[model samples]
Target: MNRRVSELGERGLIRRLREKFPSLHSIGDDCAVLPGIRCPVVTTDSFFEGTHFHRWWAPPQILGRRLLEAALSDIAAMGATAKWFFTALSVDPGIGVNWIEGFYQGLTEREDVILAGGETVRGERLGITLTVIGEGEDRDTILRRSSLHPGDNLWITGLLGRALDAPAKLEKAGGLSGKDLKPRSGFLSSAELEQLRAFLQPRAELELGIKLRKAGIRCAIDISDGLFSEASHLSLESSVDTVLEIDETLFFDSVKDNPLAASAAGEDYVLLFGAPVGLEFSSVGCSKIGRAETGNGEMTIFLDGERVSINAKGYDHLGVRK
Candidate 1:
């Protein structure tokens, strides 16, 4: 009998796989470590055409850039400097060579990030897998989600729920359902353009993470799977409860009306971290939205002094039904 991966979920499946091929270093951490290196942090992320994104939503260049940023976000969460990247791209033969060139252009635009190596293959669908390698300034200073402690304040960098607004804006503009999925110049409103930019070209908060690490803040995770889901990971790993007091103003004005947007919006790629009270981050826009407490792993969200129910879960590859 074949076992369904959905029964195990993403994390559970990873755990089972780890047991089969145990790592000499850490297994559950965000990045895999190699002993000989200078505290190297490595992670891989995949972007699929139909599953993770749609071509109509963004141009090839933007899509390529977003994919790289998503992989780099993991390195940022570990408080490491991204050094090199390798990509494996599988795309349909129908795709234009110009489109592929555009993708490479976007991926290499970042001067600091070097594309050391990659592989290309023809496939039925478009898929991009990026492996990012980074190194911490000091091995002891690298942040880990499991290191969060009780009484530590949870801080989030940048606005949340901005990505959630993109599809809605595109739908309103008839771009989503239209025959031409490519965005036409001057067709989108200013607000819609802003939403598109946020969704398509989200940046990794690498500098912020490095700053936090240098300031002696240790525990952190990038918000790739929404604040609630990622916070739950920290809570479970640290064996603590996280109480998030949602500030309406913390969200973009476009999504502030939706109370659940900030908590449930995925792909924001912002850094969510825990730090000591009164630790100042100069010129960095961050807010103390919650705190970790000693208790069973639980995540509570509050808005306007009332607990609001949110039904939307984070993006889970095995859990989400097609």
Candidate 2:
């Protein structure tokens, strides 16, 4: 009998999963791709039990699906279509074959992802890391923090605060996959869970982004960090100040008291873009909540003419407080 896997170190754990996949491409590059398309864009992310998601709130399936979504979102942020992915996992004795099977089931349901390789081990906690590979041309890959220009309007997609405030609503709305269960974190109420279910899912807006890019839309950022932090990055990068107008109607109808918090909250998986005022976009509806102005000081966030401060407090792995 294989004496429990707990003895394996991190490198040993990774080697086990690596052996499963045949070496196809070099890992020296940031990302790897097959012959489907040219000019690949690569991004990676890591999700763990306490850091990314709570084991009690979501099932193994939703956890697995979201893992792929988090990595793919980075690819989509660059306006690229995800072609393939590689994954690595770490776990403790509590995990079993059934749990891993369900995790893959959730991943497969989200998209046809081909696993390059991965591994398993016995440890004190469970964690998952994924690297996604995508393909796109120069214009379609979008710009990073340094690319935003002056005189651009800031826009955000979808509703906010719906994910962190209301987990029960999402559960009801089918936001979560596999068998339904009560939220382990106790952060979401029954109504909120239903609403969140309708909202949070593994979504890619690559199609919409490409269309906008072709239409001459330039500066953009994915709302991975709270909109407040992301906007700050844009402003700092472009050397501009931002003004955000709170649209009560645009927020999840249930949490209206502090809509900015929802907007400032993370994990909405929405895309934020900066472009010349009045450029038209198709598919997803965008809200023009702010404007950018040339400035000499640190980036500032304004809500209804008042300065609001927000840290990049969205789902940090070693940083989030349990």
Candidate 3:
């Protein structure tokens, strides 16, 4: 009889995988640590053509950029400077050569990032896996999700739901035809273009994370999954309860009238931190949403003084789709 992976859940699956191949250190942390030599941090991320993204949404170049950014976001969460990357690509033979070249061009365009090495293989669908290596400014100052403390205020950087809105915006512009997929800037209105850009080429909050580390803030996690899910992970890891008190006006201004959508939207790739006091970053907005308390990982959300029910769910590989 075959067992369903969904029955295990992500954490359980991870635990099982770790048990099968035990390592010297814990496996749940964001980056694998290699002792000595400036606390080097390493993280890997994978993107599948069908499950994670589609060609109809973004061109190959943009897709490659997004894949690399996703891996970099993990380095940012650890408050580290990304130094190099390795990519493994699984491509269908039918994919055009120009698309592959454009993907590499977009990925290598970053100023400080260097592509160390990678491999390519034939597959039925497109897949990209990126491994990012980074070094902390100071070994002692590396941040972790497990460092969150009781009474620490929770904060998030940048607007949410923009990535989630891109598909709808594309459909509204004219569905996912070939021309629509490879949309020109001149063809889209400013708002449509902005939304599409947000989805296709989201940036990692590396600088803000470095600043936060320098300012002595400790606990942080990047929002690759939804805000609610990532916040809940922090609470669980820190062994605390989190109460998310969202400011309706500010949230609406950022996300435009969909608080629930903002909470559940994934691929934002923004940094969310737990600090004792609010810290400011120029050109990036941060909002204090709630605080941590001593508890068994319970989380609550409040909107305008009324207790609102929020689904603390995000993208899960084995999770059932709605």
- Model 1 C-alpha lDDT versus the unseen true structure: 0.74
Stretches of model 2 off by over 4 angstroms after superposition:
1-33, 139-141, 166-191, 198-202, 297-322
Looking at model 1, the pairs that clash are none
lDDT on C-alpha atoms for all candidate structures: 0.74, 0.62, 0.72
lDDT of 3 by residue, 1-322 (tens): 3333344443443354344323311444554444354768899888888788777665666777778888899999999988878777776666665566566766776877767555566678878898888899776798898888888888888766666566666665543334234453325566556656676778998888898898898899998888888998999998899998765443424355566666777788988899885455434588777899989888777765556665436222221232
TM per candidate comes to 0.80, 0.76, 0.78
Query: How far out, in Å, is residue 98 in model 1?
Result: 0.2
Q: What is the C-alpha RMSD of each candidate to the true structure, in Å?
A: 11.8, 7.4, 11.6
List the candidate 1 regions with Cα displacement exceeding 4 Å: 1-36, 174-189, 309-322
Task: Name the runs in model 3 displaced over 4 angstroms.
Answer: 1-37, 174-192, 248-255, 278-284, 311-322
Which ten-residue region of model 2 has the weakest summed lDDT? 313-322
lDDT (Cα, tens digit) per residue for candidate 1, span 202-225: 899998889889889899999999
